[model samples]
Target: MHGLAKNHLKKILSTCSANRDCEYYPCHYNNQSCLWCYCPFYPCEDEVLGEFVKRKDGTLIWSCMKCNWIHKPDIAAEILREITELTLDKTTECSIDYLENRELLMQIKNKIEKKLGKSNAI
Candidate 1:
């Protein structure tokens, strides 16, 4: 995603880290593996987004049936909503499974605190 604000990245990191239960899944960026799980809420039927079982090379495997709506999200807005339990407007596009795990959250917390200092509100 381009045009990502600094605050967006910060938010994504924190919210994803809120869930320490699951391990972060790896991603492919710049032709390399980037182990960063990017989902916040627990997996459920409601959150039953879609499934993609691709070959090890990331090729498409198979699929079932679901809505055809395709929308990319903003990692920042999503994290803020997930962790803080706040709702964002529909216009707010948070990343899907971007800030998903606790490590990402800790990272965001550290960065925010470092920038604004310990007394600053995130």
Candidate 2:
């Protein structure tokens, strides 16, 4: 895996050590965890998982504060596995633009679905 990807995977695998410090520590949801404090695949084209929010400065941001799909250990692990196989040579940006990488996103989604044994993306 590339250095950036590998580092991301490591962070996902590590459970949140500061969960207790957060006001909303444990969300009442199955498999929910704080592993994905910052989603690598932020602004993913999963409308069901997130929506665009306009901040006071008029900057559009993908808000997924209520989404916990990536927090599941199994899902995170599966995503990391797929990420390890990617040849991300075109970009070095921390956040991936869904429209710009539809093919890669589809592949990762397929792998994730297969890993979870379900077609539901999430």
Candidate 3:
């Protein structure tokens, strides 16, 4: 892994905790992992996992409320591992930027879909 990514990943992984006391405890399901309170893959735009909803203001925004993929412990761990491995050769100003790379995002999505035997609808 890249030096920066390794350090950042270590920091993030170290802080993983289940905040069951939060008001939104079990936000997605009874046993969902709280490691990702805010999804790193926001606005993933993956129709299978999420969709765009139109608000009363006539504006549409991606809603992942129904998606529980990342909340699964195994999936979350796999995602972090994939991210670390994928960034081994790439360089970015911020380690988190790797998540924003289109190709990397697609790869992560594909892996999740494969593990779950689902197809992408995006």
The residue ranges of model 1 lying beyond 4 angstroms of the native Cα positions read: 1-94, 120-122
Candidate achieving the largest lDDT: 3
- Reference-based TM-score of each model: 0.23, 0.53, 0.69
Question: lDDT tens string, model 2, 25-76?
Answer: 6652543556666766666756666688899999988887656677666776
RMSD of 3: 6.4
lDDT of each: 0.36, 0.62, 0.73
Ranking by lDDT: 3, 2, 1
Model 3 lDDT at residue 29: 79
**Top candidate when judged by TM-score against the true structure:** 3
- Model 1 per-residue lDDT tens digits across residues 1-122: 55577778756544343323225321212211111233232221222334556778979643312311111123333335444442243223453344455566555544533543432111
Question: Predictions ranked by TM-score, top down?
Answer: 3, 2, 1
RMSD of each: 17.0, 7.2, 6.4
Q: What value does the lDDT take at residue 117 in candidate 3?
A: 48
- Residue clash pairs of candidate 3: none
